[model samples]
Target: MRSFPVRLPSGTRYWTVLDEDLAVVAEADAFLRHVRFGRDQAELTTRTYAGHIALFLRWCARTGRDWRTAAEELGLFVVWLRYGTKEATGADRPSTEAGLVLAGPGAEAVRKPARIENVLTGVRQFLLHGITEKAVPSQVLALLYEVADDRDLPPEARGEGMSYRMKARHRVQVPRAPRDRATDAEIVALFLACRCARDRFIVLLLARGGLRRGAAAGLRRQDVHFMPDSTALGCHVAGSHLHVVRRENPNGAWAKRQPPGSGQPVPVDVLVVRAYDQYVLERMERPHARDSDFVLVNPQELTDLHLRFEERGGSSTPLGRPTAS
Candidate 1:
């Protein structure tokens, strides 16, 4: 690379502009464009990450703080963030950053919590990118590796001072996911224990349809449809197929008798419709109750029926499985 002399506000601006590195920058731009187009990331996520990376690059250039020098200046960056407003105190020198004094919760740094937290993570990622590209020093990478998890940082170091800017990281805890959904054996075990006709169908519907309890409860008498293409329907006459639902538009009907929006055809399993149909005629609908459409609730006139249903129980309602386990 040859230095080129140019006139600037600071007199002679001599720069060693390399031709090869321009191609690298162009490639990086193309990669970001590809990420925007090719992936399924939400628009906001893509924008946020891109914006943060841009800020990191700008900061790196302004401070002449490439990855190699970042390790020596890590403490300074932390101090600059904690205090040192440019308008009041002027541009902070590297040496001046070391003895930064944090006063209280009333500090300027505490004002923008979300930006402060995100910037820390963003800068860390930018430094990592430098390491991968072999632009950063090995010492910076080693120090990054040596830092304890933020949650494990010493209480003494955390005592309000420059040390409060501990290694910023997300605290990881052991995940407690939801308990075992009915396993095949559990479903079988439950079904075997039940003698009632409706109860036997319930287990099969749950396993086959993978229906949530709320969706199951939302079923109605009118939801059942025949797939047989038969004119005359007879009771107990088995057909190869049945549709559990023919969903209408949100307004309950469309001009063309289809849903208002474009929707996909989800075929209902035969066992599920058999189950839905059985509940409607036998359990839910008496002669007077037939007017109401809901399969789960009979329309028998009763005050405060809604209140009773609301108070029934949640999905996590204890089933006494703890004793056996």
Candidate 2:
């Protein structure tokens, strides 16, 4: 067991955590190995993806690059990634105990530099996810990529006597913008005209609260609780605020319910609680064929909201009342 170095943003020696049985890298690798694959095999197993992510984080720690500074200093960290992997191995894999010490000088210098490159790529992707989620600042994101150049995704496998051209074909698409945000005006307007309690609540939660749409969509009647007895509540609304936190598979579509990020409770003001209560009461009055575990019904009561928007524009309004167009 040996520890590797990491630099925290505060300028403290974050310390080397990869050592013996207590190695952080080893634990992370083990955690990733048993990850479950959802219905979509094309998507990486959560654990597998996480394994790549840890390789990056440990390297960043070793190099003293904050999440914000990673883009520019990534190459330095990338250079050392292979060494970290060689130092850490699981029972299921071939031993890499002497991986670094045994390699020739040229191999040490050029030595599967591509593997390290892939790890850096993985970290960049993870940071990008964090940025969109607001875990990291966008300025750091711009600086990190403002200087990167590469051979795209390097290959996962290589051949003994393959053609040079064939070798270069394997590459990964770098992180691209996949998330789109509603314009502030659009978001603000949605809140003003939203007649449905569910729609109105989700809009505010996302914009003002910075919550993801998925998190809002997943809220359940039980998951929501109100704070009572203070100015926090009125008599009709009682004495409680909406408790916002992680929930079961909000829609019950996925095997597990809690979203990728974390969760919490939101105590809406008096007006919001009243709207939610109204939405629930009205939802109970309707008789739909499908079952809903949701606190908010598909304004129109459609079973699938994703497809409802694409295939059935007629039901776009979610009860003929769109979230402000």
Candidate 3:
């Protein structure tokens, strides 16, 4: 659409503004911000959504397809995600059609099932958002819910009339292998490997108490109470307990489930209490110990010790996984 000079009856000339295509990226960004601030989702969550949605938009732009009206091609979108090839070296681009499945040079890399599923879910959410914002027409929005898996429902409950046209949303997701838990012997060996009080205490804290690494790291001095009755304001638990507090810690640890300003009490065994006492009385009082409220801090990299302690606290961040045998 071009703007032409319009002659006015009173000898004045004027040009009308021409409309252009909507900026998809800008629109997507606005939607992302709405997701971040409006939905109160975590930074990492919003970032993942942005990455997935951006790929879909990029694929649409590269393939010259109207993403708004491409509901019928959703299956094709999944296929393209798995085997699409772009002609770039530094970064790979998404393509519409599949090329030769070569293992060597110029071959399109196939994505894992999980990754493809994530991208498709992101695209689905984006289209739904478009419908809510009126960027996409209401008619096309019906395609989003066109797939329904109601086989488990009673025969009378199923919408027999409208359900025929509705296909299953996507393929079944790939099953992941079960994670193996650390054995009791392994836990004992890990505890034995620690040379210092802090390291030993951290290991005991996780293996015995089943505290996540972040929860352990986020612990404060007030959180640990060896005595059954403590003077701390919020320490009302019966046994010797350490509270997992969600705080914006000076050090970089965070509680996973406990929101900021909340706390979850976890009981500790007598052995764990002894370890805590040893850490506080003997090792933590060392002159070189960093002045921080965090329960676990490395006086030195314990991984460099004689036993070569390669456990979580010694070398890097706490392993966080529960030690379940």
Identify the superior model by TM-score, candidate 2 or candidate 3: 3
As for lDDT, the candidate ahead, 1 or 3, is 3
TM-score of 3: 0.63
Q: What is the per-residue lDDT of model 3 for residues 89-144, given as tens digits with 9 covering 90 to 100?
A: 10243232333222456656468788887877767777878888988778776666
lDDT of 1 by residue, 56-161 (tens): 3434444666634565555555544446454322222324354244456666663244564565565565556556667666567665545444344567645454
CA deviation > 4 Å runs, candidate 2: 1-186, 193-195, 208-210, 227-239, 247-263, 288-291, 302-325
User: What is the alpha-carbon lDDT for the whole of candidate 2?
Assistant: 0.48
How do the predictions measure up, each by TM-score?
Answer: 0.31, 0.35, 0.63
Candidate 1 vs candidate 2: the TM-score winner is 2
Model 1 CA lDDT for position 234: 40
How does model 1 fare in lDDT?
A: 0.43
- Identify the leading candidate in terms of lDDT: 3
TM-score of structure candidate 2: 0.35
TM-score of candidate 1 versus the correct structure, residues matched by position = 0.31
Reference-based lDDT, residue 33, model 1: 36
